[model samples]
Structures are given as structure tokens and as C-alpha cells.
Target: MAVLDIKNLNVAYKSRNEKVFAVDNVSLSISEGDSVGIVGESGSGKSTLAMAILRLLSENDTEITGEIDFKGKDLLKMDINEFNKIRWKELAVVFQKSMNALSPIHKIGSQLEDIYRVHEPKIAKQKLKEKILSLFKLVNLSDRVYNLYPHELSGGMLQRVSIALSLIHKPPLLILDEATTALDVVTQGQILSEIQKLEQDIKMTRIMITHDMSVVANSCKKVVVMYAGKIMEVGNVEDVLIKPTHPYTQGLMKSFPTLKGEKKELSGIKGFLPNMSEKNKGCIFAPRCSFVQEVCHKVAPKEFEIKSGHLSACHLHGSEIN
Candidate 1:
């Protein structure tokens, strides 16, 4: 069974100017031990989708709908207490910036111990320390550093510590929301390697949200491509990255350098995203799609199965429509 299943998810933010659909109707599933990467440009609803899955968004002006089933529990309808219990135990999230995520006033060890106490209040103090040390080693960090404050640690070390803290309860599902975007290329590579090793050791299900195609290419087995708050394509990492069928996917691929010997120009997709408040008459991506036709602007496209386990939401890919 899939560990995380999202169906017909929609998120909207209301404002005087317009109501923006940050995340449109979208569905995807992640199996146990599966590494799925959600990739898109900035403002493409990648982070919004992640936040919605965690039920962490502000509810004052935003409305969220759809079912998020994690381990047979409907997260959307769960009470705050139930959601609190599920968080950091069944599912944990690693935020984008470690510095901002961790507390500056508290010692790293104290902060981690607090998390452990919250999740497993009955755990003995000595055992908690041992567990924290063990986790530090799992991420290849020194136990002595636990006494240091968040400011004392380098960006890379802070990230590793953050990862360790997030895994204090050994969550079955771990979401990395651009966890390594702040680090240098070499450090990012190291962190990615460590995460891959940890995943193999712990059998953790991972949802990696990143704009970096290289990270997705190296780490994820499956890829979810999003554009303008809607899913454009989904398939095996190799298939979507190397043999992209949708114009948006192709454009993203062209934006990144290829490993193959062929030299290709890195051209970005033209046109800005549609105003979320404006009621779309047709496909959200039609205005920016390279092969858009009259029909594309009149009717929203439905998902078409191109191959087993590979799907695309573009009219051009449909045999009957094209």
C-alpha cells in the first residue's frame, strides 16, 4: 500500500484583488521507501503542496480541500491533537532553512531532547541522549557538537543536525522541502549521499521538493512535474528526465545541462504563470505551452496514460484529441 496518498487536493488563498488557487486539483502517491521528487519553478505550488500535505498552512484566509491519506488516516479531517501525534512520529518534515527552523536560544542537544520528550515522554533521559548520539552518527556528525548552539554550526552541519532531529522518532515518511538548497554544491552532494544511505538503512519514505533537476536526477526514482499549481507529468525519474513528452517537461529538461555529449542551449520556458484569481477558461499551461492550439485554450486537458506508470496532463499527448 502507498504510504502517502493525495487525491483531488485544492488550496486557495483569498484576497481583495483575487482568490489564488495555489494548488489545483492534484493527486499522487508515494510508496514505502520510495523517493519521489516534486520539481517546479518558483511559484509553481511545489512548496504549497508540501505545506498542505502537512496541514501546516495558515487557515485564516486559505481554504484547503481534498483527502490526504497517510497510513489510512485522513489528515484533512483529523483534529489538531491527532495531527500533532502523527507529526514527528509517523511523518516528519525537514524545513528549507535549518537556521530559521532551529532555535537560537537553546542548545542543539536541548532542542533535540525536547523533541524526543514531546514524542516519547516515557523514554529515559540517558536513553534519549544515547538515541540522539546514535542519530548524530547515522548522519555522520559528532556527538560533541550537540552542546553547540545553532549559530555555532556551519550551514551543512546545521542541516545534518536538523535532519537528525526530524528523525528522532524514526518517522516512516520524511519530507525534505528544499533541505539542501542553502548549501554549496559539494556540501549538497555530501548531504544527498548521507540521506540516501540513511534511507537505505532506515527504509524511510521520502518526498523531496526541489527546483534542482540534478538532485532529482541523482536521488529520486519517480518525479512529479508541476506547473502553475497543476501537475504536468509524472513517471519514472529516467523517463521523465530523459524522455519528457510534455512541452513543459521538455522545456525544464532543456533548461538544465544534459550529461550526454550533445550540446544544447538552455532556454527557459517563455511567459509568466497565469493569475490564480482569473478563472481559467482552458488549460492553465496553455498560455505558456509551445504547442498550444485553439482547443488547448478552450478545454482543460485530462490525464492520459502514455505508458504503464507514466502519465501526462497535456492535450497534445492524447491520441484521440491530437
Candidate 2:
């Protein structure tokens, strides 16, 4: 069954006199225990989609439309209080920077305890401490580090702590928004490995939002490629990564280095992303696509089902709409 279902979701931010579209008519469904990766360059709306799923965008200046159904309930229609009850307990996020997420003034254990107490106010202090320690071990952190401050740990260790904290309540859905971006190569691998193990052991659903293809290859079973606030392709990770259907996805794959294959020089996609403030009437990626035709510039293509469990949005793929 699908754990989260989003349909025709649109997000726009008002700037001066214009509304900039950050996400446009995007629809996705994530099944239980599935690890899906949202990949794109900056401003591709990957993070915006993640934030929108949790309703974390600013209410005053941002306009969000369409349905966000989480576990059968429409989160977009929920009251703030109702959503709060589900936020940390059912859905949790580990943001990009661990340093900013952690409290510099509070000890790790105390901060974790505060989060636990907020949800379980009457729990005994000793039991909470034990739970915290166990979570620490689960993320491969030593119990000694639990008493230390954020600055006392390395960036990698701090990230591990952040992961541990997110799993404190064992939320059914955990979103990692560039959670491993700042770590070194080896450290990122270790953390990703641990996360995969945790997902298997706990049956947790994960949404890994990142620009790194290698990260998706390592940790995700499915991949969604985004460009200019729209999803260009989505499918099984091996299918999308190994045999990209969309031009944008192909460009992204070519731009990144691979470990197993014969080494090739990286070639980044050309041209800049279109200004979000302007209305796009045709394919958003037409300007940069090498195979762009007149039709691509004049008409927008709907998502086409390339095969079972695979979808792509591109005129070159023809009109096999899914």
C-alpha cells in the first residue's frame, strides 16, 4: 500500500509582484518500506517537494495547492494541531546541516530527552536515558558521545546523531534532505549503509533528497529526477540510473562520475534554468536538451509510461501518456 500520495501539487512563492513557481503539478506515490530518492540540481524543487510533503513551507508568503495524503489522511486539509500530532511521531526529517539542527548549548542526551518527553511526558528519566543510549548504538555512536555537545563531535558523528534523533520515535516515514552532503566520502558510505540496515530492520520508509547520483545508487531502490520544479522521470533506481529515458536524466547521469564503469570525462548539461517567475508554456527543459525539436518548444509533454513501473516526461518519448 502507498504510505504517501501526492497529486497535482503546486507550490509558489510570492516575490514582489510575481509568483515564482517552485513546484508544478507534481504527483507521486510512495509505497510502505520503499526508499525513494529525489535527485536534481539546485532549484530543481527537490527540497521544495520534500518540505511541501511535511507542510513545512511558510504559510504567509507561500501558496500550496493540491492534495498531500499521508497514510490515507490528507495533510493539506488537516488542522495545525492535527498535523502536529503526526509530524514527529509519524513523519520526521533530517535536514541538510547537522550543526544547525542540533542545539549547541544543550548536551546531546538532554536535547534528545526533551524531544522524547514532549511526546511521552510521563516516561521515567532512566528509561529515556536507556532509549537514547540504544538509539546511539543503533546509529553506531558510542554512549559516551551522548553526554557531549554538538561541537564536541565530528561532522560525520553529528550527522549520525541527527539520524538517531529522527528515528527516536521510529516514525514510519523519514525524510533525509541532503543529510549526508557535508560528510566525506567514506563517512557518507558508512552512514548510508547504516541507514539501509535500519530500514530493513525497522521497515521504515525513507525519502532521500539529494543531488548526488552515487548516494541514490547506494541507498535507494527507486529514483525520481526533477528539473525546473518538475519531475522529468521516475522509476526503479537501476532503470532510471542505468538507462535514463528523459534527456535531463541522461544529462545528469553523464555529468557525474561512476566507480565501476570505464572512467569518462564529465560533461555537464548546458544552459541555465528558466526563471520561475515566467510562465512556461512548453517543455521546461527544451532550451538545453540536445534533441530538442520544434514540438518540444511549443507543447508540454505529459508523463508517459515507458514500461511497467517506469515513467518519463519528454516529447521525444512520444505521446504514450501514463
* Full-model lDDT for every candidate: 0.86, 0.89
Give one digit per residue, the lDDT tens place, for model 1 in 1-322.
7998999999998777678999999898888889999998889899899899888898988899999998898999999898998888888888888557788899999989987888688988888999999888876688888898988988878888887888888788989999878777876787678778777988888999998999999989999999889999999998888788888888898899877787888899899988887768798888888788899999998888999888999888733221
lDDT (Cα, tens digit) per residue for candidate 2, span 127-190:
9999999888776789998789988998878988888888889899999999888778876787
CA shift of 190, model 1, Å? 3.1
Give the TM-score comparing model 2 with the true structure, all chains together: 0.95
Q: For model 2, which pairs clash? A: none
* Candidate 1 runs further than 4 Å off: 318-322
Q: Which ten residues in a row have the lowest lDDT in candidate 1?
A: 313-322
Taking all chains together, each candidate's TM-score versus the true structure is 0.94, 0.95
